[model samples]
Target: MKSKPVLTILHRLAILAYVVFALFPLFWLLKVSVTPNDLLYSEGVRMWPSRTSFDHYAFVIAHSAFPTFFKNSLIVAGSTAVTVTILASLAGYALSRFNFKAKYWIVALMLITQMFPLVMLVAPIFKMLSPLGLTNSLTGLVIVYTAFNVPFATFLMQSFFDGIPKDLEEAAMIDGATQFVAFRQIILPLTLPGIAATLGFVFTAAWSELLFALMLISGNDSSTFPVGLLTFVSKFSVDFGQMMAAGVLALIPACLFFLLIQRYLVQGLTAGAVKG
Candidate 1:
């Protein structure tokens, strides 16, 4: 009995340690952004600055094109996540519920797409999109993100659907409901965790995407926050404070996204524990 409390304490301490290790970089970025430029180097690796100010944040918001970049990122990431989730849900349900002749081949082809490095596809994708006027466009970025994310999202949703009992839908069918209706009301509601996880995964992937954004976008008008962070660098020097400030701002949407979906994720996890 005494050892149980000790184990519990050690477990919590381990988790706390991992959390600090993960968050240390972000904490340092926030610290540096608030540190005055004159003291940045002179402070010599201090945990917190002696003097703090919001001048970097002020400059980024008031004088830079960060707001436009933020807007572009929100549009692209949000659009991609929604598109991927909807398509993945339908595809996943099919994979879970149906057994067709081409099912194995379809799964193999999807897996093949994941085996190749994305860098290998950049030139071919760019070549294809350029003629369609998709290069240097937010819509192009969204399309690319959605296509890249869907296969994995489909697999994820399929696993979630597999966890659900087929009898639930079967019972609904016995009650005169079609497969689609049972899936819409019963299976889909039960897969909220999977859907939320897919949304967060796709949203984060689209939001932080740099290679595609850098390759496809040309000007500030279409730039995402990842690409926009480059503006802090110049021939003479890098604006560390402003760059960190922009990074901090970029994290806001991702944080808010998880916050919105966290309830569904928790609910989904606990749903399996209860019995009717």
Candidate 2:
């Protein structure tokens, strides 16, 4: 059956409406970030304020702890993303290809790790890290983030590996390449999309995590951008301008990281490797 032109136009309109509806808040945030404070309340809910200024941006960068927060968040998130991706790729490939004793149990255990709520583990994790003096440290946060992200990342990577073929590595091995060499050369190249996806996933998770950072790190020095965003709220009122400005700034690194990896994020690196 052929669809009507009017129905297709309506369908496109529906999608466009949903997209704009979902993105409206972000658009508002960007608008308010540049809006002058004097006009914040006086403007009475206008889109694209009549006047805009970079004063809040300047203040957040120069007068606040936003820079430190940005740096700490970057380091923790970048480290966690890289570490988790490395571990995940290796484990995922193993899960996809190897048939060893207890493989089922190992996969089940990793899945089990994903089942529990992270909130439930906070107390025990804090107690464990406290004795080692790691609670207040950025390294501690990275370690925790990596631990949480790895299982999911492993699963993500495993799906990608499963999508790829066994024949490519088998061929490489037949050509005298070791398993590691074959993986590093042939398999890894095919899994670039999975790697980019995992890295972006882990990085964004660690970047915006606030509850754990708030619970673990008490000092201003080690606070991540999410936690620092909270500091903009005083006992009486929130500094909307500065907070919005900081939020906009915090989005930059994630945007940049994705932009850097987007080239390899295209699907189907393994299309021709196997027969249908």
Candidate 3:
């Protein structure tokens, strides 16, 4: 009984430490967002401000081009996520189940594609897209982001598909359903968790990707939120509060996305799709 209490105390301490570690940055962001410009340096690194205001958030949302950047980021991220997930699901399922000549070589090539550093390919990608007049376009960003994210997403989705049994689809086939019908009506439903995971992964990756966005997109019209964040910096000083406020604001979609999918993200999407 005494040991149990000691263990409980230790568990509580661990949880407390983790919470502080994880939440401290967010707390700081909120604190700095509210800290007025005058007191920013004057306060000299104190926890909690002597005063607080909504001015930074107000300015960021109103006076800044952040909204447009935000919209563009959303379009790119959302499009990339949906496209990559759909492609990954189909490709992953194929990788997981079907076998044909050159399958090994095809998988090897896909793996090779992932091995090359993205930075090395950026110029070539730009050149290819430039001739097609896709540069500075949201569609171009989507295509690029989808291509980059799909290989990883495919591995992610293939693992999920592997976790499911091939028997389910076989049973459906025996019941006279076509393979695509079995995939749609049977296997797909059970892969919701994996789908949600892939969407979240790809969305978050594209949402924050800076290099490609910065390289391919030129004007504010095509800027993503990450590139827009750079506008807060001038040749002189950085606007810390406004930047933090923008950072906070940029987190909304990703958080809302996870919240929307959290229920389906429950761990058992494939529970009945297989047996031990």
For model 3, name the residue pairs that clash.
none
Model 1 agreement with the true structure over 176-203: per-residue lDDT tens digits: 8888889888888889999999999999
lDDT of 3 by residue, 242-262 (tens): 999999999999999999999
For every candidate in turn, the CA RMSD to the true structure comes to 1.7, 1.4, 2.0
User: Per-residue lDDT of 1-276 in model 2, one digit per residue for the tens?
Assistant: 999999999999999999999998888889989999999999797878899999999999999999999999999999999999999999999999999999999888888999998899999999999999999999999999998898889999999999887888889999999999999999898999999999999999999998899999998999999999999999999999999999999989999999999988987666777786
* lDDT for model 2: 0.93
TM-score of each: 0.96, 0.96, 0.94
Off by over 4 Å in 3: 1-5, 272-274
Candidate lDDT (C-alpha), each: 0.93, 0.93, 0.92
Ranking by lDDT: 1, 2, 3
What's model 3's lDDT at 260?
92
Positional deviation of residue 133's Cα in model 2 after best superposition, in angstroms: 0.6
Off by over 4 Å in 2: 1-4
Error of 3 at 156 (Å): 0.9
Q: TM-score of the candidate numbered 3?
A: 0.94
